[model samples]
Target: MARKASLSGFPEWLPAERVVEQHVLDTLRRTFELHGFANIETRAVETRAQLLRKGEIDKEVYGLSRLSAEDDKNDPNALALHFDLTVPFARYVVENAGHLAFPFRRYQMQKVWRGERPQDGRFREFTQADIDVVGDGTLPFSYDVELALTIADALSALPIGDFCLRVNNRKLAEGFYRGLGLEDPDAVLRAIDKLEKIGDEAVAKILVEEVGATADQAAAALALAKIRTLDTSFVEEVRALGVEHELLDTGLDELSQVIAAASKRAPGKVMADLSIARGLDYYTGTVYETVLVGHESLGSICSGGRYESLASKGKKNYPGVGLSIGVTRLVSRILAEELVTAARSVPSVVYVTLAHDDSWHEAQDVASALRERGIACEVASSAEKFGKQIKYADRRGIPFVWFTHDDGTHEVKDIRSGEQVSADPASWAPPASDLHNTVA
Candidate 1:
């Protein structure tokens, strides 16, 4: 017989764990809508050309084809699974530009696929919750500030412990690199983006060799990455670096404004950290990376940036800023670390016990009455003893079991506290806390 085996990259959760995940997703959705972002879902697959618009993620895209296809490459319209929501959303914006209102704000939660190798918190298939604000031409920088606060609102509502959102501007990093006399600052930004992963020394080597930076220049670039501040003080820190450029000055002021604004509202939640050079090449302005309090090694649980130039089609270019929560990665980390759990595995709030097989219909009737009142419940499959019936509820962490007495009246058993009380199927209800399974 063929043995059952689990795939390494694709993750499946038990019913209880799924409860926790769903709660997190629901929290994110509610928070996003409360902030005025409308819901939008794009297709899961995009043309290879549309996905390749970003230019850097082509290799990581999963191409779609059929086994019977003779020449997939020559199709000119080959489909590929979207590696992230941004690209598909961009394509959607361009395609729907005629109907969509200007300065559209939307939230999308969906699965995305990537062909990259997976380990720890990373996966080949994952879910992402993205909120974006796109404009017809130039978008307000205030939207950037708003997105930061909105993201904070969403994350703070979850069980993920205290987190620090390290904010930066691509202009800041690139301008600093340019001010340091690096001919290819974009390339340097790409290299130093590896600073957190490969360390300063290795990043410096890439700068000095591939990016054509001298030893001192590389050191200065590394020095900039070290500047981290909880408030507007990051302004002086960059000034202290002594690297000056028109773009550098502009970036510094812009970043300082965002940090100051965020601080005034959500104190201690947002900060300036120069090391947060998001790996994506599309980011043109403010970028963010979030690290949980003690789980720093787990990497950013959430991250995003501003892309001013996207899906440019014949005089129309979509510009936007956005954030995405790595849903699967965040849930996986919380589960693996035991950060939170569901109260129970089953959704049933109460289980109806059967006195005998002849009473099955009555038991089901009770269950149906509870359902009509918005209470979830299930009827016992067999007419077992009351003790055995209560044991069934106990094993599943179900809080209550219903019993019908000889008088045709009903009694509810609280399995947890050994408490029993008379109840009516029409009027009786479980406590508010037992209405549904919860994550804590």
Candidate 2:
């Protein structure tokens, strides 16, 4: 017999850890809904054409092959798994254009698959919590600021520590690059995006060698990317760079408004970072990236941007602004750092022990009574000694152990504090805090 092989990049959480993940998701769902974003779901699979419409993810999409039909295996327009939720959401908006209300605010939480190589904190299969606001023709710039504040609020609710929601405008970067006499701003943005991974020297070399940029152009781009400010001072910093273009001026104004709005709403949660170039070409306005305070190496745990045309049906275009929380990555870091923990391994708050085989009937009665009172409990199956039952309850992290006495009285013992007291299952109940597994 052959042993099973554990595949990499596919995350499988243990029971206790899964509780934490669920808690985070629940918190995000509640926050998004409270902000008036309705729940929406999209299909997991998409046509290869739809998946690859973004241009960059052609090789990063997983194509399907049907064993039943071998002749059409080479079909170019076959099905593929969506690498991200944004692309699928765009298609869905167009498909259901007539039914959906304009300025649609939706929150989608689902697993998205990517064929890219998995690394630390990066996965081939992961979950994302996304909230997007799409409008008919022109989306309000306030939507951009609103989404950033919403992400900050959602992250603060979770157990993840302080984070930085770095905000940058693509228009700002492109306009500045053009003002510096760079012909290919997008190509330069791509190289500059690699600035952190490969050092400033390597990125500058790429700009001059590959993008046909002069030494001065490469130097100016590096200088622009190095700017980081906590407020609207980034506008002045860019102005001091000596680049002048009407587009650049417009970008500065847009970025200043976003930063000022975010600072007023979220205070220190949002920062102006010129280096953040979200690689997607569709992000025509503000782009975002969030980093856990001390865990910067884990990369952005949440990110997204404002797109002018998230979807199009003939002449009608749906522009939107949104943000996505990388749920799987955040949970992985939480487990690894021991940042939070479930109150109990099982949802069972009380373990009703059997004094003997004959006590099964009474134990069952007590269990039923406790459950009727909204207390989570279970009756021990075996006919075990009282000591053994305590150990059994202790092993599984069940906080309380219930024992029925021969006198027809009942006593509940708290395994955590070792405090035992007389109680009636019909009247007595566990504390609301300890009733269920808690992520603490």
Candidate 3:
């Protein structure tokens, strides 16, 4: 017999870990809904051409086809797993523009596939939670600030630790680069994006040697990258560089506006960081990347940016700004470090015990009653010793178990506290607060 090969990038977790994932998802969905973002889902597979519209993401696309299909192996046609929710969302907005409300706010949580080497905190298959808002004609500059603030608020609501929402303007970056006489401004932005990874020395080498920046220019750019401020003063600090370029000034103004607006809405949540040059090619205005304060080495757990035009239908233009939380990455690190946990084994509310073969139907009735009240319930598979059944519930982390006695009385056991109380099955209710277990 051959030993089974373990796949490198595909991650699977135990039931306990899955509970944590579910809790995270539930929290996100609730927060998004509370803020009036409608839910939307797009197909997992899209045409290859559509996926490759943005050149940077093309290499990471996981193209797929029928395994048994015999014809046309050389000329692969349209079919690839979605790499992120934003692209498909752009397609969705363009396809369904007429039906949607202007300045549409949407929340989409889904699995995205990427064909990249997996490593710690990086996976080929993972889930993302994306929230975006697109206006019909032209999005207001205010929408830009609101989008960033809302995402920062969402992250702050999570069980995760303090996170810094790093904000930058692509226009600002472009202006600074173009001011420096760089023809391909994206090349310089790409180099700056590596500031966290390659350090100041290596990034300076790339900027000066590879990108043809002057030694003085490289040092100045590195100083800009190192510029970090908690408020809008970052704009003033960058201006001190005295790049002598109109575009850089305009970029500075835009960054200043965004930071001021976000601060008014969510004080101390947003920070101005000149180094946050998100590598995506489509972003034309503001870009966002959030880092956990103590876990800065873990990288950005949430990131997104603004695009000038999401649709190129040869007609109307659709501009939008959005952010996505890497739910899988956040959950993976939290679970690995034991930083968070699920309160219960299952999401069920009550577990009804089958006391004996003759009492099975009564157990079903009890479960059905709870279900009628919107409680999730489960009945034991068969009558077993009370101790054994309680042990089963304990193993599953069931908080409460209901059992019937020979005297025609019913009892509900608070398994965690080991407290049992006699009660009428039809009238008994779990305390409102005890209905759901919460993480400690």
In model 2, which range of ten residues has the least summed lDDT? 1-10
Best candidate, lDDT-wise? 2
Residue 173 alpha-carbon offset, candidate 3, angstroms: 1.9
Candidate 2's C-alpha runs over 4 A off are 1-5, 71-77, 358-361
Comparing 2 and 3 on lDDT, the stronger one = 2
Q: Each model's TM-score?
A: 0.96, 0.94, 0.93
- Over 125-235, each residue of candidate 1 has an lDDT whose tens digit, in order, gives 899999999999889898989999999989999999899888999888888888888878778888878988899889989988888899999999888889988899988
Give the Å error, residue 216, model 2.
1.6
Q: Model 3 reaches what TM-score against the true structure?
A: 0.93
Which candidate comes out best when scored by TM-score?
1
User: Please, what are the lDDT tens digits per residue for candidate 3 over residues 1-440?
Assistant: 11111786677777667777877888889888888899999999988877776666677887687788654323446588999998899999989988999889999999999988887668888999999989876888777787887787788778887888999888787787777777778888999999888799999899888999988878877888888777787876777777667777777787788788877887887888989998888888889999888888788899988887886466688888899999988988888777777677677767788877888888888888787876777889988888888888888777788987787788889988889998775677777765765554
How would the candidate models be sorted by TM-score, starting from the highest? 1, 2, 3
